[model samples]
Target: MTATSPTPSVVSSVSTLVRSPAPAGLVGHRRAGRSPAPLTTGRARRARRVLAARRRPADRDFRPDIEGLRALAVVAVVVYHAGLALPGGYVGVDVFLVISGFLITRQLLKSVGRGGLRALPTFYGHRVRRLLPAAVVVVLATTVAFRFVGPPLKVRDVATDALFTAFSGLNYRLAWVGTDYQHMGAAASPLQHFWSLAVEEQFYVVWPLVIAVVAVATRRRHLRLVLALLVVGVVAASGWASATLTPANAPWAYFSLHTRAWELGVGALLALAAPRLVALPRRLAGLAAWLGLAAIAVAAVRFTDATPFPGVAAWLPVGGAALVVASGCGPRVGAERLLGEPLVQCLGRVSYSWYLWHWPLLVVAPYALGHALGVGERLAVVWVSLVLAIASFTWVEQPVRLLHWPTWGWIGTGATLGGVVTACSALVMVLGPVTTGTGAAAVLASVDAPGAAAVTVAPAVAGTGPAASAATSAAEQAVARTVAAAVGTVQVPSNLTPLPQDAADSLPPTSRNGCHAGFTAVSQGDCRYGDLTAARTLVLFGDSHAEQWLPALDQLGKAQHWQVVSWTKAACPAARLTVDNPSLGRSYTECDTWRDATVARIGALHPALVVVSQSENVASSSVVPQAFSAATVATVRALRSAGAPRVAYVQDIPTPGTDLPGCVATHLDDVRPCTYDRSAAYRYPDRHAALAPALATASVPVLDPAPWLCTATRCPAVVGNVLVYRNESHLTVPFSRWLAPVLAPVLTTTGA
Candidate 1:
């Protein structure tokens, strides 16, 4: 719908279009239509003036009950989000949406009757006053809390999110993150409230224009017809889109203007049709209201985080809200009385502030404490949110909206907000990296190590000759001589060189670095060196999922005397075929370019062996295993054709769980209880099945490590006192070291 054009002539003609008042007599109760006895003639005229001051030609008496309904909606939202035993409470947002549409449409229609259906600036001014004050206060407070208390990763992520909150795009962001908000845990964002605000703000931007266009186009001739068409169109479009998209596409469906339009349209329809609908008998109206409340309550109790949302499921709350709006006060029924009770009405009055304050409190509280909230902590957060909401409503929101602040005052407010954001951004920019802590740094460092540990094996007893022993002695002597020369002319001790500082630092506290070529410092003679200084270099590559095997590789390196160089990037799998590079601002580039270069360099050095893996978990689009197999076949053929020998491909480990860290953390106390659903973990079994053919065609020996890692029933957590994995699909250092004995036999095999 197009916006209402703001022409000077239209503004001047506003007063000429006022409508006549509604019929003076109440059709039902005799007491309803009668005015309260006038105190005096002067007082009566003042009352009339007050009525006239409402500024709408067809303006009816104020309905404070609607405000009471708003309070109910906000309370439901707050309570459900607080993890109270109310599931359907989130539907309150739908209630508010309908309410907003009704109120906004009513105001616009009243203005149209008095003036000439065009006052875009005045409408915007009222909205700015109504919303901005409370929004700004909440956003500022959330930003401050985030800067000091949030986790390093979250702090960095939410800086952008806070900006989205300020601009009203939070709904989009939340949707993009996926709907399993509860599972996100510490990773859950702070500016989640922006989703509802986004719906409202988006509505405000478009609804006024639609109203103006319809009012002008038909001049109220076919307004109902036009409104009906709009509602049907929006509902259809939203339903179609929601059904077609995956859960990952929730943001586009939930946050986009098209999908959310029907909700506001329902509200708009209510405003235009309320007079007729409200004429029903009070008993029936009351029944409808109670039924509506029941629907909303039921939804709250039954809905869980996994529920497919804002699709057909959204109808429960929307329908409930529509019923309440149509019902008004019922005859002989206590529903209206229950809703209009002082407590409910008061909550409705301050509901806006409550909505603004609750989420930030919930998000920041647990983060500040460095833990997720237990039941008690979540309740405390809820209480604190209520207190803050009430205070903001009373002290900041109400005052700013009521006061006649000058243009300069608004400018000053904007500047203050801008300054606050800029300062927070600067603080985050300066401190974010420093606060990411030593953990990530250590992880990256360990990831950069050259190879696993190297061990010297004795010659075979019977058939093997002294030639093998002689060759081994020569290699050991060469390593010792190189160390002696590098450190000065002193005699080098066996296993004397230190592991790379990065690798050592990167390993977890429980890990023991074995004697490898790079490590030299010894405290208690526990091997601390990574064997990166081997005669041959073997590069390990793939996504973070694949890179998790560093510990195992380190163990293998010590046994085989092979350098395990890692060229891994998060979310990137090793493949010879081209795929999109999201970070590179390019598309369809080879995923294995870095690995290829490393292979060329290693080939030039002519290492005795080359080992490759990452055949599984590659992007389907890249046909990763096939590409990797082709590359390996070419490399092996090139090497074999050159008379070089010994190249092998290791099959990838099975993914343990969908969100390994969260699952493990959640079930940390459970023993003999860890479980994984293999179906959920693997989206493409066919792709995994396809890898075997490629590996066979390449004629490379495939090392299936799954049997070593998984058992008959499950992939157990511990293997010989070492945690099998540090995360979802990666091996812990201790576990990798444990695999050293098993891997040694495989590495020494001669043929492909």
Candidate 2:
């Protein structure tokens, strides 16, 4: 998060006090700005006091080092978001929070000291001028730019995020959506980075009032002590909450102000003790500064995406920032000298605007270019954002901040900007939904557009002999007719089963009913699906890939007089390998627990058949296919040992990485672009190859579903007037139900 408040104005306010030349006696005694020789006599001691007075804490003057620190923090964040090697660069937000706490607290405490909260209005006015102008510009620019470059399906999300940013509530919105599994896969919002700005702004609203209350309660005496106690209380409570919640609910812990306020409180504690910290010896101060930098560097280099964050991990960067600010209270150090470099200062100057502009450009560029950006293109985006930030800082930020305006003028400025965002967001929402003009349903119906029939019909229809009909079954013959009629089908049917916009909601009964578990769920709760009273039981087991077949299984089970039980969870693969869930930022212990419980539950059910399916993408980069296959074979053996009469492993469908609904909507006229090559979907290191040998040894049959969903070389996004894959991989409910007839024979046969 960019620290919205800059130090230049604060530094300028105290410049006259610190910038004046030394007295005549000091000029002779002090050589080249170094302090005079150590005082021994009473007269020398008095001169020493004067020198100390001249060397006031850097906090009381323009500390270019603070500006340089801002540069470091923003650069880290940018690099991390740009997919660089610095995994822990996210700690930059912690540094900014601490800095905000220290700087804002200093200003507030000074106000209380002067006139007992008389400066509250002025403090807020300054904040408005400093923060809102540049933010409004970026929000407006992002909304407009995305409107032009982004897909229509994503327009509404970006607009909503922009509106929240304008209202200073983006963090709350992000927190809610971050934990929502349904929306988790949506394209990144351009204004998503504004969540940090929202955090700072929210803190600003509450902290000044706290200072005012403390001053009144203490009768303006012992105010610092009371304030310190209050800050400590906040730190303890928020820190405890962060530590407890991060592993269990990372999104709320990461984005909520309640969990984040402690970092700022740490900075506030430093501000309270600033007056006394100036007495530290120069050597000790220099050491502290270097140690602080070292701590920050260690965190940035050592931590990774899998590290649980914003709890104990945050203390490193937060404490380091405090030390840096505390060091500024004494003398200049090596850290300070490096921080004050011209290039660092320049970066610091426009860091706020750069933070605002960089994320939006990175998100929109791929859509605009119609492809993912290469490393060179990403670097180009970084440069372009820097240029825009410089321009925003020079023109909009300086002009609005320097203007001499009344309180009402500031209020009006905020309202106008907010209004513009609202209007723009409304415009985006109104224009977001796109329709591929209606096509002829008659053409599709006449051809009997083959949905699953594509796989079976092609081979049988190609054969001219009457023996082909004799060779194929009755159900296969029906599929053959649909496939033959739909051979050259290219136009998308007007009567599409699930409209593109609503396609993602095509979940199975188990998913809708509480049978399908969520990420944190450990047990498969009452997941029985069909023919509840049937004598024979069938179990559908694994992750979402298994759940995707539920519509078919449910219908088939009822017709075949078999009970259907669904055991599934989001992102929790049936494979035995332990996963590192990026969302939780840790090893997926919950998944292991769920898998164990599911195995026990299935053992108790003593199902006549257990059909297992898991996503091909389940094995992450760290887990090799051999490990996955071994784990899977073990699971199959365990199932047989637990009384499952038969076990079948269904091969996963080819994953079309593109969002099918959005692609269908965007390329409605030319459906060919929406189809995926079979080779790409079944690319290298195939899960089937790994599992085949082990499964064969275990005598478990492997069922390939490709023959039902695809042709020899490609898989169409839409088939037989029904949308196929809903999002990236899951099949739509309508399509899954259509497969019930084809899937029935395999489930019924003794060999299956």
Candidate 3:
């Protein structure tokens, strides 16, 4: 879970990527073979005080324990992402925050104590060398890998994320999309890990400027008190805000810098008191370090997804990290010794690179394989990420950071790489969906055309009475045979093409017109189609599944002289029943209200016909068929009593467990791997099954789209060379529109 604020997860991204892990051996070590100057009494004493005043603790007070701490944080994050344990492993990011604050603040105060601000060029150059090279390589490589592993739309989304990663603004992009990282039941952006990095970078960029101003204000006075108060003030206010805001606004509290400022501020304050902390007796310091470690351990194991994040809940980890950092400097205790081991230090050394590499691999691997990762596979993911991290550290990070480049050279390198990343991302956007490989296009051409011979399970012959019922079986069987032959004869495309050409903006026209009443909507409304002026209105109403039929409805209305009105909201169906929506993590009051008002609006319109559909996630009393049936009956009865002359309900299509397009891409050589068992799909409970008896009483017919979507024992991702769905359970407009010839007559049949 990355919000790991409503909670922010661990980082290589936004608030997570705090700084270059300085590592154990890099700090507190002098050039090899140099010896301390021989005793010089009075002259040495004066020089010692001068040097102390001139340098910050970070320059001389480096402890290997901090590196071990970094090791712990990154491991918690990795283990959590791999689904091993630690529901709150995301708090490792909060630990990183404190560590970052301590390091940066100590460095700044050292500069201040030395009688001036650190040279900006030198400071920025160091940061650039330490962080930029590895970041650029990772973002560039992730972008390239995404083109192969993801759907075209996903490729576009990841490209945009790559651009944001280059600029360190991925958190803002995620906020715009209302991304709840903990419950990404669908395809998630791999670069979502970078959101934490963005936050950390933001802190890095702004904190220095503020500290520089404060340093100037103190102007060589005893500035510790003033700085401590400033840090305390931020800690108090930001902590209070996080506690207050998180329940109602978790995403904002999780992602926003302001909400998280207190954790970092507290670490900075600890840095201000570093000398006193170090002055403590060894036994007490050892006790504190062990206790702090215990607190962190408890938090890692006990915290859950529902735990309100980064507010008061954060103190457990944040305070523990601060205590360990403060106490670790005093003595080499058992805790310190354990943390200082070679393996731990090595893990800490490559922690940043590991953080950067793990997330994309975790997100992309399962998608590439078309299945969820097992324990062994998850371990492989971690091992591969570790190998890549080691490569990044050795090849990109160490080599560039060790160089003695001039400040301008560092700046130039950063700018050139940044620009290249931006251009590559922009070029992907410009190129649009990669309409690659003429092979699929050729396979689709012969069978995908609207003019291709139309066939299906037929509708009833229109007549006055019993004869229509008698002829129904023959008509349907003839249509079924025709459809089966035509479908079986056509070549199936090995891979699906993300459709609507503008795949990234594939939302329906109603959504654009603000009438599709998504979960964000406050009220119900209508967006009309076909001949808007036509008197005989045909209304398509329900949740997004109903919206999927819009392409067909619009086509039918234009050709058959019926006006189409859409009344839909995401996740809200016309069935009046209490249901749980996991995405919202609540009863979904907004969806309930939208459905009530939408149905009422439909009644008011008194249209010639009303069509309704919903999702399996929706049910009457519960997620059961019988309950949905009762709910469907009650809803339809109300509509009929409210003057709905005729009504129809649609059964949802088969659920694709994985992203259909991504699956197809992974097995482009053959699509056999993408097919799912039809019996299992059909066995899934249907709301329509319960609705049928109720509808029969009211003369409302049921619409089952199964024949077009599945065969007797198999449900394939593709049919007649057209991709059926873009994701788990929604129809692509192109595929929906292609079904018009089969769906038209059935829709025109007036009665049950």
Give the per-residue lDDT of model 3 (tens digit) for 585-658.
Answer: 44567777776776778889899988877775555333577766677778888888788868777767667666
- How much is 657 displaced in model 2, in angstroms? 2.6
Worst-scoring 10-residue span by lDDT in model 2 = 459-468
Rate residue 643 of model 3 by lDDT. Answer: 83
Model 1 regions lying over 4 Å from their true place: 1-62, 112-118, 179-186, 219-225, 246-248, 329-333, 405-423, 430-433, 436-752
What ordering of candidates by TM-score runs from best to worst? 2, 3, 1
* Per-residue lDDT of candidate 1, residues 327-357 (tens digit): 6622323566676666666666668887888
Residue 4, candidate 3: Cα error in Å is 33
Per-residue lDDT over 1-752 for candidate 2, one digit per residue giving the tens place of the 0 to 100 score: 12233246433422431343322211213558775566579767555544553475534745566777888889988988888668888888888888888888888888855556676777887788889888888888888888878876677778989888888999999888786655657777889999988999899888888888778878889988988988899999999999988988788899999999899899899989887786666677789988988888888888777778887889998888888888877656779888876677777778888888889989988989999998988888887787777667777887787799996678777788789889999998887766452557732231223334323443221122232233244555454455333434566778787888778788887777777877778885767767889888888989889999999898887877888889998778887778866666667888889988788888887888998888877567666677778889888887877777688777687778779888877866666778777778854355656776667677666655664566666677777788887888889998878767756655665333
TM-score of each: 0.57, 0.84, 0.78
Best by lDDT: 2
Name the top TM-score candidate.
2
Give me the runs in candidate 2 sitting further than 4 Å from their true place: 1-62, 83-88, 112-122, 172-187, 240-252, 298-308, 374-376, 442-473, 476-489, 512-514, 531-537, 557-563, 621-627, 683-685, 690-702, 750-752
Better of 1 and 3 by lDDT: 3
RMSD of each: 15.9, 6.6, 8.5
- At residue 668, candidate 3 shows an lDDT of 50
Per-candidate local distance difference test = 0.55, 0.76, 0.70
